[model samples]
Target: MLWIPATLAAAAAQTARNATQRRLTETIGTAGATQVRFLYGFPFALVFLSIALTLSGERLPRPDGGFFAFVVAGAVAQILATALMLAAMRERSFAVVTAYVKTEPVQTALVGLLILSDPVTPGGLAAILVATAGVIVMSGVGRGAGASWRPALLGLAAGAFFALSAIGFRGAILALDSGGTLIRASTTLAWGLGLQTLILTAWLLALDRPALTGSLRAWRPSIAAGFLGALASQFWFLGFALTTAANVRTLALVEVLMAQAVSRRLFAQGTSGREWLGLVLVTGGVGALLWFHA
Candidate 1:
């Protein structure tokens, strides 16, 4: 399905965005870096909307009350999730934190089921479980002491928020009264980024002017991060428009391998044999999901 390639592309773009955001976090602080994805990304999202509209020759879909509710909820939840993810990045190796956040697929399935009535067949449920178990294996849950657990807590918390955000986003896409999949998905991307930008901008202006300023001073890299973020979100929304949030997110687990490659190449972090085993499981689970979907 189209969703397969869309999800894969989203995963690749997201990996790049996450790497950029992690670098930005060192100088901008977590929330500051988090806002970069929305603030700098919003303009690109608008561009994506324009291109989608022009190409599809579709008018923007009229948002219903349900759309507003879902989009707002999605926007806010994603903000919290990104902040937590950056915080977790500060605590652990980039790959490890990513593995922790990858747990969101299972959580997304549950939340999507509860909030949006998205159904998961038995095979899909099994695939989700297997994939999640791989993430748990890669997370090294029982390792370390004292503050070592902090990253795990933060990452899992981020995963939970990310799950909620995914459900909200999928629901928002479904709420549109008209427009083809591309138009609806792009429009929702614009709305979500717009809300996130406003919310983060207001917070930075009120609470942390310096971090906001820092992001601006580093705008060169911020723009790159923003573009990647927008690109990723656009594809993610397209995938959501085509399938259940669970399916989209479960397929996105490929991001774990992408992150691992980045970690090894960029961060010089090595993956243990156990982690390789986990990767196998994750791949198998994703393959199973695809087969079940087919």
Candidate 2:
């Protein structure tokens, strides 16, 4: 299959994962929910990474100093981003949270350009602006008079952390000297997930022992969320390995549409006019980017 289709599938899977996460949050609370997902998902990630390594017939390489640091940083950033996102979800509508999350593409591109020194064409810049405008519209930024800026600010922070995580993971993958792509990708994912589990687990225990204990006691629902989260991360890593972070992040905007569908069905709310317009703009922007790049 083409990369586009694969990316679309990944985006769809990510959307489903987000919906599951949102549901998980309702029962476990945001922090507790995240702790459960990461803690439970850690083992699954190890298993999947091991399976990928075995199938590829590649030996895992010992990560160098830089590689280790990158993975650890990425894992930490992802954990922070997820925590912020879940918090935002608790405070805002699903549509609002998703629209903010879609800003990941823009943040990723900018970070890649500045930090990684990735080259950007004029067309790419234009696409970024258009997509950003779409996100602002979808967010109802100025329309909600007296609406607190907390959600938007929190969402943006989450997106920024997510961008950092993406950059960190990609850096780790590139730092690996392993000849096998599958092995390198899997190894990076394993380390990242492992680090995330450790850090988040420690943080939860230190600050919120009761929530952590509650989540552990009610492990049934958390198991599914954990499994789905691990599965989604695997696909996300695969896509990142195959394409530039900018491209993958841009395509991942499909998650917003998927989230919208879920919100409509599960939450029984239609999109606002601004959100509909924003969706159109975002679609146009994404199409423009794809066409220009192609």
Clashes per candidate (backbone, < 3 Å): 0, 0
Clashing pairs in 2: none
* TM-score of candidate 1 against the unseen true structure: 0.99
Residues 1-294, candidate 1: write the lDDT tens digits. Answer: 999999999999999999999999999899889989999999999999999989988888999899999999999999999999999999899988998999998889888888889998999999998998998898888887868789999999999999999999999999998999999999999999999999999999999999999999999999999999999999999999999999999999999999999999998999998899889999999999999989
**Roughly what TM-score does model 2 have, to 2 decimal places?**
0.94
What digit string (tens of lDDT, one per residue) describes model 2 on residues 1-294?
A: 144665677677667767777877887788887786688888888998789877877777888999988888888888889889889988888877988877888788888788667666788768877877888889987566565478888888998898999888888888888746667777787788788778877888899887788788768877877887777777777766776677777767767778888899987768988899998888877787788778
Worst 10 residues of 1 by lDDT: 139-148
Candidate 2 achieves a global lDDT of 0.79
- Write down the RMSD of candidate 2 (Cα, Å): 1.7
Top TM-score model = 1
Among residues 3 or more apart in sequence or in different chains, the pairs in candidate 1 whose N, CA or C atoms overlap within 3 Å are: none
